[model samples]
Target chain A: MAESFEITDEMKARVGVESPPWTFEVTTTGVRAFARGVGYTDPVYYDIEAARKAGYRNLPAPPTFHGTPIYIPGKSEETFSTPLECDITVDHGLPNTIDGGKVTEYYEQICAGDTLTCVTKLASLDLKVTGSGITMFIQTIEFKFTNEDGKVAVIDRLKVINH
Target chain B: MAVTWDNINEGDSLPELKKKPSLTQMVKFAAGNGDFNPLHHDFKYFACEYLGSVLVQGHFRYAALGELVQTWLGHNQGGRIKKMSCQHRGMDFPDADITCKGTVDKKYEENGEKLADLTIWTEDNEGKQNSPGAATIVFV
Candidate 1:
Protein backbone atom coordinates (compact mmCIF):
# COMPACT_ATOMS: atom_id res chain seq x y z
CA MET A 1 0.00 0.00 0.00
CA ALA A 2 1.26 3.48 -0.79
CA GLU A 3 1.34 6.33 1.69
CA SER A 4 -1.82 8.38 1.29
CA PHE A 5 -2.53 12.00 2.21
CA GLU A 6 -5.71 12.83 4.01
CA ILE A 7 -8.10 15.14 2.24
CA THR A 8 -8.81 18.10 4.48
CA ASP A 9 -11.93 20.16 4.65
CA GLU A 10 -9.79 23.21 4.09
CA MET A 11 -8.67 21.78 0.79
CA LYS A 12 -12.27 21.22 -0.19
CA ALA A 13 -12.99 24.86 0.61
CA ARG A 14 -10.40 26.02 -1.91
CA VAL A 15 -12.55 25.06 -4.85
CA GLY A 16 -13.31 27.83 -7.32
CA VAL A 17 -10.19 29.72 -6.25
CA GLU A 18 -8.79 31.50 -9.28
CA SER A 19 -5.13 31.55 -10.21
CA PRO A 20 -3.16 34.43 -11.70
CA PRO A 21 -3.35 35.10 -15.42
CA TRP A 22 -0.78 33.55 -17.79
CA THR A 23 -0.01 35.67 -20.85
CA PHE A 24 1.52 34.33 -24.09
CA GLU A 25 2.10 35.29 -27.68
CA VAL A 26 0.88 33.44 -30.75
CA THR A 27 3.85 33.41 -33.11
CA THR A 28 4.09 32.00 -36.63
CA THR A 29 7.04 29.84 -35.68
CA GLY A 30 5.01 28.24 -32.93
CA VAL A 31 2.03 27.95 -35.25
CA ARG A 32 3.87 26.14 -38.03
CA ALA A 33 5.67 23.80 -35.70
CA PHE A 34 2.50 22.99 -33.85
CA ALA A 35 0.63 22.32 -37.08
CA ARG A 36 3.28 20.14 -38.66
CA GLY A 37 4.02 18.37 -35.39
CA VAL A 38 0.53 16.87 -35.35
CA GLY A 39 0.92 15.99 -39.02
CA TYR A 40 -1.46 18.79 -39.87
CA THR A 41 -1.25 19.43 -43.65
CA ASP A 42 -3.45 22.48 -43.93
CA PRO A 43 -1.60 24.97 -46.11
CA VAL A 44 -3.32 27.80 -44.25
CA TYR A 45 -1.37 26.91 -41.13
CA TYR A 46 1.96 26.71 -42.94
CA ASP A 47 2.30 28.83 -46.07
CA ILE A 48 1.75 32.55 -45.53
CA GLU A 49 0.39 33.13 -48.99
CA ALA A 50 -2.03 30.25 -48.56
CA ALA A 51 -3.23 31.70 -45.27
CA ARG A 52 -3.83 35.16 -46.75
CA LYS A 53 -5.70 33.54 -49.57
CA ALA A 54 -7.81 31.62 -47.06
CA GLY A 55 -9.06 34.94 -45.55
CA TYR A 56 -7.10 34.81 -42.29
CA ARG A 57 -4.70 37.59 -41.30
CA ASN A 58 -2.00 34.97 -41.03
CA LEU A 59 -1.67 31.49 -39.61
CA PRO A 60 -4.56 31.26 -37.19
CA ALA A 61 -4.20 29.68 -33.78
CA PRO A 62 -4.95 26.01 -34.48
CA PRO A 63 -8.09 24.99 -32.59
CA THR A 64 -6.43 23.89 -29.33
CA PHE A 65 -3.22 25.88 -29.67
CA HIS A 66 -4.26 27.83 -26.58
CA GLY A 67 -3.74 24.65 -24.58
CA THR A 68 0.02 25.05 -25.17
CA PRO A 69 2.02 27.29 -22.88
CA ILE A 70 4.06 30.17 -24.25
CA TYR A 71 7.73 30.45 -23.26
CA ILE A 72 8.44 34.15 -23.44
CA PRO A 73 11.78 35.27 -24.79
CA GLY A 74 14.51 36.05 -22.23
CA LYS A 75 12.34 34.60 -19.46
CA SER A 76 13.17 31.52 -17.44
CA GLU A 77 11.07 28.57 -18.58
CA GLU A 78 10.70 27.45 -14.97
CA THR A 79 9.06 30.75 -14.14
CA PHE A 80 5.88 29.66 -15.91
CA SER A 81 3.88 26.61 -14.96
CA THR A 82 2.47 24.13 -17.47
CA PRO A 83 -1.03 24.46 -18.86
CA LEU A 84 -2.37 22.08 -16.21
CA GLU A 85 -2.36 24.77 -13.49
CA CYS A 86 -4.14 23.18 -10.50
CA ASP A 87 -1.95 22.33 -7.53
CA ILE A 88 -2.83 18.72 -6.76
CA THR A 89 -0.53 18.54 -3.76
CA VAL A 90 -3.06 19.28 -1.11
CA ASP A 91 -3.41 17.66 2.30
CA HIS A 92 -5.04 14.73 0.54
CA GLY A 93 -2.29 12.17 0.05
CA LEU A 94 -3.32 11.02 -3.38
CA PRO A 95 -0.79 8.61 -4.80
CA ASN A 96 -1.53 8.83 -8.51
CA THR A 97 -2.64 11.66 -10.77
CA ILE A 98 -4.34 11.37 -14.13
CA ASP A 99 -6.06 13.62 -16.63
CA GLY A 100 -9.83 12.99 -16.68
CA GLY A 101 -11.05 15.00 -19.66
CA LYS A 102 -11.42 18.35 -21.42
CA VAL A 103 -14.50 20.33 -22.48
CA THR A 104 -13.67 23.29 -24.69
CA GLU A 105 -15.74 25.97 -26.38
CA TYR A 106 -14.38 28.22 -29.10
CA TYR A 107 -15.98 31.59 -29.66
CA GLU A 108 -13.80 33.74 -31.91
CA GLN A 109 -10.76 32.78 -33.97
CA ILE A 110 -7.30 33.39 -32.55
CA CYS A 111 -4.86 34.56 -35.20
CA ALA A 112 -1.09 34.63 -35.18
CA GLY A 113 0.47 37.72 -33.51
CA ASP A 114 -2.49 37.89 -31.12
CA THR A 115 -1.61 38.11 -27.47
CA LEU A 116 -3.61 35.82 -25.18
CA THR A 117 -4.14 35.82 -21.44
CA CYS A 118 -5.43 32.78 -19.58
CA VAL A 119 -7.07 32.92 -16.17
CA THR A 120 -7.77 29.62 -14.51
CA LYS A 121 -9.44 28.43 -11.32
CA LEU A 122 -10.35 25.21 -9.65
CA ALA A 123 -13.96 25.05 -10.72
CA SER A 124 -15.26 22.03 -8.85
CA LEU A 125 -14.03 19.36 -6.45
CA ASP A 126 -15.96 16.18 -5.82
CA LEU A 127 -15.24 13.00 -3.90
CA LYS A 128 -16.67 9.66 -4.90
CA VAL A 129 -16.57 6.12 -3.52
CA THR A 130 -15.98 3.77 -6.39
CA GLY A 131 -16.78 0.08 -6.92
CA SER A 132 -13.27 -0.83 -5.91
CA GLY A 133 -13.86 0.77 -2.49
CA ILE A 134 -11.32 3.43 -3.35
CA THR A 135 -11.94 7.05 -2.53
CA MET A 136 -11.28 9.30 -5.52
CA PHE A 137 -11.41 13.02 -5.90
CA ILE A 138 -12.23 14.58 -9.25
CA GLN A 139 -11.14 18.17 -9.66
CA THR A 140 -12.35 20.33 -12.49
CA ILE A 141 -10.29 23.34 -13.45
CA GLU A 142 -11.70 26.00 -15.74
CA PHE A 143 -9.54 28.16 -17.97
CA LYS A 144 -10.69 31.39 -19.57
CA PHE A 145 -8.61 32.63 -22.48
CA THR A 146 -9.03 36.18 -23.70
CA ASN A 147 -7.54 37.69 -26.80
CA GLU A 148 -5.71 41.03 -26.88
CA ASP A 149 -8.95 42.71 -27.88
CA GLY A 150 -10.28 41.59 -24.47
CA LYS A 151 -12.73 39.12 -25.94
CA VAL A 152 -13.16 35.59 -24.78
CA ALA A 153 -11.60 33.36 -27.38
CA VAL A 154 -11.80 29.97 -25.76
CA ILE A 155 -13.04 28.49 -22.51
CA ASP A 156 -11.62 25.13 -21.46
CA ARG A 157 -12.70 22.96 -18.58
CA LEU A 158 -10.28 20.21 -17.61
CA LYS A 159 -10.91 17.47 -15.10
CA VAL A 160 -8.14 15.89 -13.04
CA ILE A 161 -8.45 12.63 -11.17
CA ASN A 162 -6.48 11.93 -8.02
CA HIS A 163 -6.53 8.58 -6.31
CA MET B 1 -13.64 15.37 -53.46
CA ALA B 2 -14.91 17.27 -50.46
CA VAL B 3 -17.35 15.64 -48.04
CA THR B 4 -20.50 17.62 -48.45
CA TRP B 5 -23.60 17.81 -46.30
CA ASP B 6 -25.52 15.34 -48.44
CA ASN B 7 -22.92 12.61 -48.88
CA ILE B 8 -22.65 10.72 -45.61
CA ASN B 9 -25.05 9.22 -43.11
CA GLU B 10 -25.12 8.43 -39.41
CA GLY B 11 -23.54 5.18 -38.16
CA ASP B 12 -20.89 5.55 -40.84
CA SER B 13 -17.32 4.84 -39.77
CA LEU B 14 -14.25 6.85 -40.68
CA PRO B 15 -11.11 5.10 -41.82
CA GLU B 16 -8.53 4.49 -39.12
CA LEU B 17 -5.73 7.08 -38.96
CA LYS B 18 -2.58 5.69 -37.43
CA LYS B 19 0.92 6.96 -36.75
CA LYS B 20 3.94 6.48 -34.55
CA PRO B 21 5.03 10.07 -34.01
CA SER B 22 8.80 10.32 -34.09
CA LEU B 23 10.95 12.07 -31.49
CA THR B 24 11.56 14.77 -34.04
CA GLN B 25 7.83 15.25 -34.28
CA MET B 26 7.46 15.62 -30.53
CA VAL B 27 10.30 18.12 -30.36
CA LYS B 28 8.93 20.18 -33.21
CA PHE B 29 5.48 20.11 -31.60
CA ALA B 30 6.96 21.14 -28.25
CA ALA B 31 8.77 24.02 -29.89
CA GLY B 32 5.77 25.42 -31.71
CA ASN B 33 3.35 24.67 -28.88
CA GLY B 34 5.54 26.63 -26.45
CA ASP B 35 5.62 23.71 -24.05
CA PHE B 36 9.07 22.66 -22.87
CA ASN B 37 7.86 20.53 -19.99
CA PRO B 38 10.42 17.87 -19.12
CA LEU B 39 7.78 15.20 -18.85
CA HIS B 40 7.37 15.33 -22.59
CA HIS B 41 10.94 14.40 -23.56
CA ASP B 42 12.82 13.55 -20.39
CA PHE B 43 12.72 9.79 -20.07
CA LYS B 44 13.93 9.64 -16.47
CA TYR B 45 11.35 12.03 -15.06
CA PHE B 46 8.54 10.59 -17.12
CA ALA B 47 9.34 7.01 -16.13
CA CYS B 48 9.84 7.80 -12.46
CA GLU B 49 6.88 10.10 -12.03
CA TYR B 50 4.40 9.57 -14.83
CA LEU B 51 5.22 5.84 -15.23
CA GLY B 52 5.92 6.31 -18.91
CA SER B 53 9.13 6.42 -20.91
CA VAL B 54 8.29 9.61 -22.78
CA LEU B 55 4.86 11.10 -23.02
CA VAL B 56 2.95 12.56 -25.95
CA GLN B 57 1.19 15.85 -25.30
CA GLY B 58 -2.57 15.58 -24.89
CA HIS B 59 -3.09 18.29 -27.48
CA PHE B 60 -0.79 16.46 -29.83
CA ARG B 61 -3.24 13.59 -29.88
CA TYR B 62 -6.06 16.07 -30.39
CA ALA B 63 -4.28 17.56 -33.37
CA ALA B 64 -4.16 14.13 -34.95
CA LEU B 65 -7.86 13.67 -34.38
CA GLY B 66 -8.50 17.10 -35.86
CA GLU B 67 -6.60 16.17 -38.98
CA LEU B 68 -8.48 12.92 -39.24
CA VAL B 69 -11.82 14.71 -39.06
CA GLN B 70 -10.79 17.41 -41.52
CA THR B 71 -9.56 14.84 -43.96
CA TRP B 72 -12.81 12.94 -43.65
CA LEU B 73 -14.95 16.06 -44.01
CA GLY B 74 -12.75 17.26 -46.82
CA HIS B 75 -10.61 20.44 -46.69
CA ASN B 76 -13.06 22.42 -48.75
CA GLN B 77 -13.56 26.04 -47.79
CA GLY B 78 -17.10 25.56 -46.54
CA GLY B 79 -16.78 23.05 -43.71
CA ARG B 80 -16.30 24.58 -40.26
CA ILE B 81 -15.38 22.67 -37.12
CA LYS B 82 -17.11 24.32 -34.24
CA LYS B 83 -16.05 22.34 -31.17
CA MET B 84 -14.17 19.26 -29.92
CA SER B 85 -13.87 17.61 -26.51
CA CYS B 86 -11.35 15.05 -25.26
CA GLN B 87 -11.37 12.73 -22.27
CA HIS B 88 -7.84 11.47 -21.65
CA ARG B 89 -8.21 7.89 -20.48
CA GLY B 90 -4.56 6.82 -20.41
CA MET B 91 -1.01 7.84 -21.25
CA ASP B 92 0.68 7.44 -24.65
CA PHE B 93 4.43 6.91 -24.72
CA PRO B 94 6.78 8.13 -27.41
CA ASP B 95 7.09 6.01 -30.57
CA ALA B 96 4.00 4.01 -29.73
CA ASP B 97 1.69 3.21 -32.62
CA ILE B 98 -1.57 5.08 -32.02
CA THR B 99 -4.66 4.59 -34.14
CA CYS B 100 -7.66 6.91 -34.42
CA LYS B 101 -11.18 5.72 -35.20
CA GLY B 102 -14.63 7.22 -35.03
CA THR B 103 -18.25 6.93 -36.09
CA VAL B 104 -20.67 9.53 -37.27
CA ASP B 105 -23.00 9.78 -34.30
CA LYS B 106 -25.63 11.86 -35.99
CA LYS B 107 -26.32 14.33 -38.81
CA TYR B 108 -28.64 17.28 -38.87
CA GLU B 109 -29.20 20.71 -40.33
CA GLU B 110 -29.08 23.70 -38.04
CA ASN B 111 -30.28 26.99 -39.49
CA GLY B 112 -29.57 25.71 -43.00
CA GLU B 113 -26.02 24.52 -42.18
CA LYS B 114 -25.39 20.79 -42.56
CA LEU B 115 -23.54 19.28 -39.65
CA ALA B 116 -22.28 15.94 -38.40
CA ASP B 117 -21.37 14.81 -34.88
CA LEU B 118 -18.50 12.37 -34.54
CA THR B 119 -17.36 10.28 -31.63
CA ILE B 120 -13.62 9.70 -31.94
CA TRP B 121 -10.60 8.42 -30.04
CA THR B 122 -6.95 7.30 -30.21
CA GLU B 123 -5.68 3.98 -28.92
CA ASP B 124 -2.24 2.66 -28.00
CA ASN B 125 -0.35 -0.22 -29.54
CA GLU B 126 -2.21 -2.58 -27.23
CA GLY B 127 -5.53 -1.19 -28.48
CA LYS B 128 -6.41 0.39 -25.18
CA GLN B 129 -8.12 3.73 -25.60
CA ASN B 130 -6.01 6.69 -24.56
CA SER B 131 -8.19 9.59 -25.59
CA PRO B 132 -11.93 9.38 -26.29
CA GLY B 133 -13.49 12.53 -27.66
CA ALA B 134 -16.11 14.06 -29.90
CA ALA B 135 -16.07 16.64 -32.65
CA THR B 136 -18.70 18.76 -34.39
CA ILE B 137 -18.18 19.70 -38.03
CA VAL B 138 -20.37 21.87 -40.25
CA PHE B 139 -20.36 20.85 -43.88
CA VAL B 140 -20.81 22.93 -46.97
Candidate 2:
Protein backbone atom coordinates (compact mmCIF):
# COMPACT_ATOMS: atom_id res chain seq x y z
CA MET A 1 0.00 0.00 0.00
CA ALA A 2 1.12 3.57 -0.71
CA GLU A 3 1.27 6.39 1.84
CA SER A 4 -1.64 8.82 1.76
CA PHE A 5 -1.14 12.59 1.56
CA GLU A 6 -2.64 14.99 4.09
CA ILE A 7 -5.18 17.44 2.68
CA THR A 8 -4.19 20.81 4.06
CA ASP A 9 -5.92 24.13 3.49
CA GLU A 10 -3.32 25.18 0.92
CA MET A 11 -3.44 21.80 -0.72
CA LYS A 12 -7.21 22.05 -0.76
CA ALA A 13 -6.97 25.38 -2.58
CA ARG A 14 -4.80 23.63 -5.13
CA VAL A 15 -7.07 20.65 -5.53
CA GLY A 16 -6.74 20.79 -9.27
CA VAL A 17 -2.95 20.89 -9.45
CA GLU A 18 -0.82 19.35 -12.17
CA SER A 19 1.66 16.61 -11.45
CA PRO A 20 4.96 16.17 -13.30
CA PRO A 21 4.86 14.14 -16.47
CA TRP A 22 5.22 10.37 -16.13
CA THR A 23 6.22 8.03 -18.96
CA PHE A 24 5.26 4.38 -19.35
CA GLU A 25 6.63 2.01 -21.95
CA VAL A 26 3.81 -0.08 -23.37
CA THR A 27 4.44 -3.77 -22.84
CA THR A 28 3.11 -6.77 -24.77
CA THR A 29 2.14 -8.58 -21.59
CA GLY A 30 0.19 -5.60 -20.29
CA VAL A 31 -1.69 -5.35 -23.57
CA ARG A 32 -2.59 -9.02 -23.68
CA ALA A 33 -3.73 -9.14 -20.07
CA PHE A 34 -6.05 -6.15 -20.43
CA ALA A 35 -7.74 -7.64 -23.49
CA ARG A 36 -8.08 -10.99 -21.81
CA GLY A 37 -9.25 -9.37 -18.58
CA VAL A 38 -12.12 -7.82 -20.52
CA GLY A 39 -12.84 -11.25 -22.05
CA TYR A 40 -11.58 -10.42 -25.57
CA THR A 41 -9.90 -13.53 -26.99
CA ASP A 42 -9.24 -12.17 -30.46
CA PRO A 43 -5.97 -12.99 -32.15
CA VAL A 44 -5.29 -9.37 -33.11
CA TYR A 45 -4.34 -8.70 -29.48
CA TYR A 46 -1.81 -11.54 -29.52
CA ASP A 47 -1.10 -12.83 -33.03
CA ILE A 48 1.56 -10.66 -34.72
CA GLU A 49 0.82 -11.89 -38.22
CA ALA A 50 -2.87 -11.17 -37.79
CA ALA A 51 -2.04 -7.63 -36.71
CA ARG A 52 0.25 -7.15 -39.73
CA LYS A 53 -2.49 -8.48 -41.97
CA ALA A 54 -4.81 -5.96 -40.37
CA GLY A 55 -2.43 -3.12 -41.38
CA TYR A 56 -0.75 -2.72 -38.02
CA ARG A 57 3.03 -2.69 -37.76
CA ASN A 58 2.76 -5.23 -34.95
CA LEU A 59 0.19 -6.60 -32.53
CA PRO A 60 -1.82 -3.63 -31.36
CA ALA A 61 -3.17 -3.03 -27.86
CA PRO A 62 -6.86 -2.86 -27.11
CA PRO A 63 -8.71 0.44 -26.86
CA THR A 64 -9.05 0.36 -23.06
CA PHE A 65 -5.47 -0.87 -22.66
CA HIS A 66 -4.22 2.70 -22.35
CA GLY A 67 -5.48 2.81 -18.74
CA THR A 68 -2.67 0.44 -17.80
CA PRO A 69 -0.04 3.07 -18.55
CA ILE A 70 -1.81 5.89 -16.75
CA TYR A 71 -3.19 4.05 -13.69
CA ILE A 72 -0.15 1.97 -12.83
CA PRO A 73 1.90 2.07 -9.60
CA GLY A 74 3.23 5.63 -9.16
CA LYS A 75 1.68 7.62 -11.97
CA SER A 76 -1.64 8.54 -10.31
CA GLU A 77 -1.09 8.25 -6.54
CA GLU A 78 -0.76 11.75 -5.07
CA THR A 79 -3.54 12.75 -7.41
CA PHE A 80 -5.66 10.10 -5.65
CA SER A 81 -5.90 11.95 -2.35
CA THR A 82 -9.26 13.26 -1.25
CA PRO A 83 -9.77 16.83 -2.41
CA LEU A 84 -9.82 19.53 0.28
CA GLU A 85 -13.47 20.45 -0.29
CA CYS A 86 -14.88 17.02 0.53
CA ASP A 87 -17.11 17.41 3.60
CA ILE A 88 -16.09 14.05 4.97
CA THR A 89 -14.24 14.48 8.24
CA VAL A 90 -11.68 11.78 7.46
CA ASP A 91 -10.64 9.68 4.49
CA HIS A 92 -10.49 6.09 5.58
CA GLY A 93 -13.32 4.14 3.94
CA LEU A 94 -13.68 4.76 0.21
CA PRO A 95 -11.05 4.57 -2.50
CA ASN A 96 -10.67 7.90 -4.30
CA THR A 97 -12.75 6.79 -7.29
CA ILE A 98 -12.83 8.35 -10.74
CA ASP A 99 -14.23 7.15 -14.02
CA GLY A 100 -13.59 8.83 -17.39
CA GLY A 101 -16.68 8.51 -19.52
CA LYS A 102 -16.53 10.51 -22.71
CA VAL A 103 -15.71 10.20 -26.38
CA THR A 104 -12.02 9.69 -27.17
CA GLU A 105 -11.05 11.62 -30.26
CA TYR A 106 -8.55 9.27 -31.81
CA TYR A 107 -5.64 10.79 -33.72
CA GLU A 108 -3.56 7.65 -34.24
CA GLN A 109 -3.62 3.94 -33.57
CA ILE A 110 -1.04 2.56 -31.15
CA CYS A 111 0.82 -0.34 -32.65
CA ALA A 112 3.29 -2.61 -30.87
CA GLY A 113 6.72 -1.28 -29.77
CA ASP A 114 5.35 2.18 -29.11
CA THR A 115 6.61 4.03 -26.04
CA LEU A 116 3.85 6.35 -24.83
CA THR A 117 4.43 9.32 -22.55
CA CYS A 118 1.64 10.86 -20.52
CA VAL A 119 1.31 14.42 -19.17
CA THR A 120 -1.39 14.58 -16.51
CA LYS A 121 -3.05 17.63 -14.91
CA LEU A 122 -5.97 18.30 -12.60
CA ALA A 123 -8.46 20.07 -14.82
CA SER A 124 -11.21 21.22 -12.45
CA LEU A 125 -12.94 20.69 -9.10
CA ASP A 126 -16.34 21.63 -7.71
CA LEU A 127 -18.42 21.10 -4.60
CA LYS A 128 -22.19 21.03 -4.69
CA VAL A 129 -24.71 20.36 -1.94
CA THR A 130 -27.31 17.89 -3.04
CA GLY A 131 -30.87 18.33 -1.75
CA SER A 132 -30.43 15.02 -0.03
CA GLY A 133 -28.15 14.57 2.93
CA ILE A 134 -25.26 13.82 0.63
CA THR A 135 -22.80 16.42 -0.57
CA MET A 136 -21.10 15.71 -3.91
CA PHE A 137 -17.58 16.90 -4.64
CA ILE A 138 -16.31 16.23 -8.15
CA GLN A 139 -12.77 16.56 -9.49
CA THR A 140 -11.66 16.14 -13.07
CA ILE A 141 -8.17 14.94 -13.95
CA GLU A 142 -6.98 14.98 -17.53
CA PHE A 143 -4.08 12.97 -18.96
CA LYS A 144 -2.59 13.39 -22.41
CA PHE A 145 -0.71 10.57 -24.12
CA THR A 146 1.97 11.26 -26.71
CA ASN A 147 3.92 8.89 -28.85
CA GLU A 148 7.66 8.72 -29.63
CA ASP A 149 7.30 11.27 -32.45
CA GLY A 150 5.77 13.71 -29.94
CA LYS A 151 2.37 13.36 -31.55
CA VAL A 152 -0.68 13.30 -29.31
CA ALA A 153 -2.24 9.85 -29.18
CA VAL A 154 -5.09 10.09 -26.65
CA ILE A 155 -6.67 12.22 -23.93
CA ASP A 156 -8.21 10.69 -20.79
CA ARG A 157 -10.57 12.78 -18.64
CA LEU A 158 -11.21 11.11 -15.29
CA LYS A 159 -13.95 12.40 -12.99
CA VAL A 160 -13.37 11.65 -9.31
CA ILE A 161 -16.27 11.55 -6.85
CA ASN A 162 -16.37 12.11 -3.08
CA HIS A 163 -19.65 12.09 -1.20
CA MET B 1 -18.02 -8.00 -44.12
CA ALA B 2 -17.60 -4.27 -43.60
CA VAL B 3 -20.44 -2.49 -41.79
CA THR B 4 -21.69 0.60 -43.61
CA TRP B 5 -23.44 3.70 -42.27
CA ASP B 6 -26.40 3.19 -44.58
CA ASN B 7 -26.98 -0.23 -43.07
CA ILE B 8 -27.89 1.34 -39.71
CA ASN B 9 -29.43 4.50 -38.36
CA GLU B 10 -29.81 6.61 -35.22
CA GLY B 11 -32.14 5.59 -32.29
CA ASP B 12 -31.42 1.94 -32.98
CA SER B 13 -31.43 0.20 -29.62
CA LEU B 14 -29.47 -3.01 -29.26
CA PRO B 15 -30.64 -6.05 -27.27
CA GLU B 16 -30.60 -5.46 -23.52
CA LEU B 17 -28.28 -7.55 -21.36
CA LYS B 18 -29.97 -9.03 -18.27
CA LYS B 19 -27.62 -10.10 -15.52
CA LYS B 20 -27.74 -10.65 -11.75
CA PRO B 21 -24.55 -9.87 -9.90
CA SER B 22 -23.70 -12.56 -7.37
CA LEU B 23 -21.20 -12.42 -4.53
CA THR B 24 -19.03 -14.81 -6.50
CA GLN B 25 -19.14 -12.54 -9.52
CA MET B 26 -18.06 -9.55 -7.44
CA VAL B 27 -15.24 -11.47 -5.81
CA LYS B 28 -13.98 -12.78 -9.15
CA PHE B 29 -14.02 -9.34 -10.72
CA ALA B 30 -12.43 -7.77 -7.65
CA ALA B 31 -9.70 -10.38 -7.77
CA GLY B 32 -9.12 -9.98 -11.50
CA ASN B 33 -9.00 -6.19 -11.38
CA GLY B 34 -6.67 -6.16 -8.33
CA ASP B 35 -9.29 -4.24 -6.34
CA PHE B 36 -9.84 -5.91 -3.01
CA ASN B 37 -11.72 -2.97 -1.55
CA PRO B 38 -13.94 -4.53 1.11
CA LEU B 39 -16.88 -2.36 0.06
CA HIS B 40 -17.42 -4.90 -2.68
CA HIS B 41 -17.34 -8.16 -0.70
CA ASP B 42 -17.37 -7.45 3.01
CA PHE B 43 -20.98 -7.45 4.05
CA LYS B 44 -20.13 -6.57 7.63
CA TYR B 45 -17.74 -3.88 6.45
CA PHE B 46 -20.43 -2.34 4.32
CA ALA B 47 -23.11 -2.67 7.01
CA CYS B 48 -20.91 -1.48 9.84
CA GLU B 49 -18.34 0.74 8.16
CA TYR B 50 -20.03 2.07 5.02
CA LEU B 51 -23.75 1.60 5.72
CA GLY B 52 -24.67 -0.88 3.01
CA SER B 53 -25.45 -4.57 2.67
CA VAL B 54 -23.28 -5.86 -0.18
CA LEU B 55 -22.05 -3.85 -3.16
CA VAL B 56 -20.64 -4.66 -6.57
CA GLN B 57 -17.56 -3.01 -7.99
CA GLY B 58 -18.55 -0.27 -10.44
CA HIS B 59 -16.06 -1.56 -13.03
CA PHE B 60 -17.85 -4.89 -13.18
CA ARG B 61 -20.83 -3.12 -14.65
CA TYR B 62 -18.50 -1.40 -17.14
CA ALA B 63 -17.18 -4.78 -18.20
CA ALA B 64 -20.72 -6.02 -18.66
CA LEU B 65 -21.45 -2.94 -20.74
CA GLY B 66 -18.42 -3.81 -22.87
CA GLU B 67 -19.90 -7.24 -23.39
CA LEU B 68 -23.12 -5.66 -24.60
CA VAL B 69 -21.13 -3.46 -27.03
CA GLN B 70 -19.16 -6.35 -28.51
CA THR B 71 -22.33 -8.32 -29.05
CA TRP B 72 -24.07 -5.33 -30.63
CA LEU B 73 -21.22 -4.54 -33.02
CA GLY B 74 -21.33 -8.10 -34.34
CA HIS B 75 -17.69 -8.82 -33.53
CA ASN B 76 -14.89 -6.69 -34.96
CA GLN B 77 -13.42 -9.27 -37.37
CA GLY B 78 -9.83 -8.00 -37.14
CA GLY B 79 -10.29 -4.29 -36.57
CA ARG B 80 -9.37 -3.02 -33.09
CA ILE B 81 -11.51 -0.60 -31.10
CA LYS B 82 -10.12 2.87 -30.69
CA LYS B 83 -11.63 3.73 -27.27
CA MET B 84 -14.48 3.29 -24.75
CA SER B 85 -15.62 5.68 -21.98
CA CYS B 86 -18.27 5.04 -19.31
CA GLN B 87 -19.73 7.21 -16.54
CA HIS B 88 -20.94 5.35 -13.46
CA ARG B 89 -24.12 6.82 -12.01
CA GLY B 90 -25.29 4.34 -9.40
CA MET B 91 -24.33 1.37 -7.27
CA ASP B 92 -25.22 -2.33 -7.51
CA PHE B 93 -25.71 -4.45 -4.46
CA PRO B 94 -25.44 -8.22 -4.54
CA ASP B 95 -28.27 -10.11 -6.28
CA ALA B 96 -29.45 -6.98 -8.10
CA ASP B 97 -30.78 -7.43 -11.61
CA ILE B 98 -28.74 -5.21 -13.90
CA THR B 99 -29.48 -4.65 -17.59
CA CYS B 100 -27.26 -3.10 -20.26
CA LYS B 101 -28.50 -1.29 -23.37
CA GLY B 102 -27.24 1.12 -26.06
CA THR B 103 -28.18 3.02 -29.22
CA VAL B 104 -26.33 3.86 -32.43
CA ASP B 105 -26.13 7.66 -32.28
CA LYS B 106 -24.44 8.09 -35.70
CA LYS B 107 -22.24 6.47 -38.26
CA TYR B 108 -19.31 7.81 -40.22
CA GLU B 109 -16.03 6.84 -41.84
CA GLU B 110 -12.72 7.63 -40.15
CA ASN B 111 -9.29 6.86 -41.48
CA GLY B 112 -10.72 4.49 -44.09
CA GLU B 113 -12.65 2.48 -41.50
CA LYS B 114 -16.37 2.45 -40.76
CA LEU B 115 -17.01 3.83 -37.27
CA ALA B 116 -20.09 4.11 -35.11
CA ASP B 117 -20.79 6.64 -32.38
CA LEU B 118 -22.63 4.54 -29.81
CA THR B 119 -24.47 5.95 -26.80
CA ILE B 120 -24.77 3.28 -24.13
CA TRP B 121 -26.29 2.93 -20.65
CA THR B 122 -27.16 0.36 -18.00
CA GLU B 123 -30.23 0.12 -15.77
CA ASP B 124 -31.41 -2.06 -12.93
CA ASN B 125 -34.83 -3.71 -12.42
CA GLU B 126 -36.15 -0.54 -10.77
CA GLY B 127 -35.17 1.55 -13.85
CA LYS B 128 -32.07 3.37 -12.64
CA GLN B 129 -29.17 4.28 -14.91
CA ASN B 130 -26.07 2.58 -13.63
CA SER B 131 -23.48 3.55 -16.20
CA PRO B 132 -23.82 5.90 -19.17
CA GLY B 133 -21.21 6.71 -21.80
CA ALA B 134 -20.15 6.49 -25.44
CA ALA B 135 -17.80 4.26 -27.39
CA THR B 136 -16.20 4.88 -30.81
CA ILE B 137 -15.85 1.55 -32.57
CA VAL B 138 -14.30 0.90 -35.97
CA PHE B 139 -16.53 -1.69 -37.60
CA VAL B 140 -14.62 -4.35 -39.49
**Candidate 2: share of reference interface contacts reproduced:** 0.21
Q: What are the chain B TM-scores of all models?
A: 0.89, 0.85
Model 2 per-residue lDDT tens digits across residues A1-163: 1132233464366555555566655666655655555555667767788767766687665654443433544323333222223212324233444443443445667766888777666666655555664445566667777889999887767676665
- lDDT by residue (tens digit), candidate 1, B1-140: 55666777899888888878877788887776666666677777744365647788787887788777766765345666677888887878777899988889999988987888989999887889899999888776
**Local lDDT at B25 for model 1:** 85
Contacts from the true interface found in each model, as a fraction, amount to 0.57, 0.21
Candidate 2 has a DockQ of: 0.29
In model 2, state the lDDT of residue A74. Answer: 38
Best by lDDT: 1
Q: Which residue pairs show collisions in model 1?
A: A5-A93
Model 2 chain A scores worst on lDDT over the 10 consecutive residues at A81-90
DockQ of candidates 1 onward, in order? 0.51, 0.29
Stretches of candidate 1 off by over 4 Å are A1-8, A67-93, B46-52, B74-76, B109-114
Local lDDT at B10 for model 2: 74
